[model samples]
Target: MNRRSLLAIAASAACLLSMGLAHAADQDTLAAIREAKTIRVALEFGRPPWGFKDDKLKMSGSDMEAAELLASDLGVKLEIVEVTGPNRIPFLQTRKADVVLSTFSITPERLKVIDFSAPYASAVQIVGAPKSLPLKSEADLKGKRVGVTRATTGDVELTKKAKDFGVEVVRFDDESTNMTALASGQVDIVIQEPATLTAVAARNPQRQLEPKFIFTQFPVGIGLRKNDPALKSYLDQWVKTHMADGKLNAIYRKYHGTDLPAEIVKPTN
Candidate 1:
């Protein structure tokens, strides 16, 4: 080959090699986790059913169980990284955690910031109030004080409609506080996950809290950084396999007192 042609070929090869390395650097989350031999899973210890601490002060919840299984499947040690509703995505964005399994609802708004695996669990946002409150519809919420955990799906969804419904939105830093507000009558109603509302009712039966209306139903997934195709793909497959084998459902039933929705167990997409 001519000297000029040989020189051109060498330059092109170098450029291609550099490009490949840059791409790999951008998408090495899975590789990095494997190399470190540990997966840091962000979870909300204050959110029950999904995540919380037991009486022994040890982490114990469905999300905790799922995180353990994920690490075991990947053959890595599991490291729990405590996160809250507001900061879960930020933790993933800042690489503070390898993945977030903190009852992260997959919404279009959230999808804009981070990628997610297929739905691993399903949840619903609801408005709950005392049974005698006569809240039969959204219109009945007019002028009512509604409590919600800041940045949670229920908060986001309720806030968007609060103005139209004439609802007074009261935000709390966490689910525990939100529930407290309702039980204490600081808020006339609350928007939260059904499981949380149920928990609150069980603890404060005199409050007579009952679901007023379902705001929205959504699927939850493992939150990952955007552009990490390898990590996203691996988690998607992991969720599918576990769902098919009933392991995921078993965990759901263990905490939820019922099986996961069929659509979530066998998602069409």
Candidate 2:
């Protein structure tokens, strides 16, 4: 071969090698977890029924149970990494956690940063307040003070329509904080998932807080880094299998005292 032709071939081979390495990296997540024998699952520790630390400070909830199952399925040790609503996706993107089981909802903005498994759970954002309150619908929220966890679906949705609803939004760092605000009467109402609202009301019956109005439905899923088709596919299949076998329903019932939502169990996309 001529000198120039040999040089060109060498450059092409190097380019191809780099591309192959990049592709391999995309599939490395599952392999890395297997090799490490530890699967780090991120979850929010304050959202009860999904995930939360018990009185003993041990993590226990449906999301935590799901993480435990996933780690066991992979034959790896489970390392629970507590994350907040705002930092969950960042943890996945920074490779700080292999998977996030923090009741993460699949949305267009979130899909841009990370990929999600098939639906694992579903929750509706609702306005929760005392029965004495005049809350009947979105229109009733006018001039009311609403508390929401910052950066959550409830916060995003409420902030978007607060002007129209004529409500004041009080942002908190976590659900517990927001719930406390509502319970202590610092906020007239709280925008949060139905699970948390129910749990909060159960714990503090004196608050008289009840579901006022549903704002939107949030289909929750396990979150992972984008571009990892192998890991994403594995999680999707795992979700499908568990949903079919009723394992997910058992977990849901254990926490929520109800069957898993049918739509979440049979996720369309």
Q: Which stretches of candidate 2 lie over 4 Å from their true place?
A: 1-16
Off by over 4 Å in 1: 1-20
Cα lDDT of candidate 2 equals 0.87
RMSD of each: 3.3, 2.3
* TM-score on alpha carbons, each prediction: 0.91, 0.91
| Residue 106 alpha-carbon offset, candidate 1, angstroms | 0.4
- Model 1 residue 48 CA deviation (Å) reads 0.7
lDDT value, residue 225 of candidate 2: 87
**Highest lDDT, which number?**
1
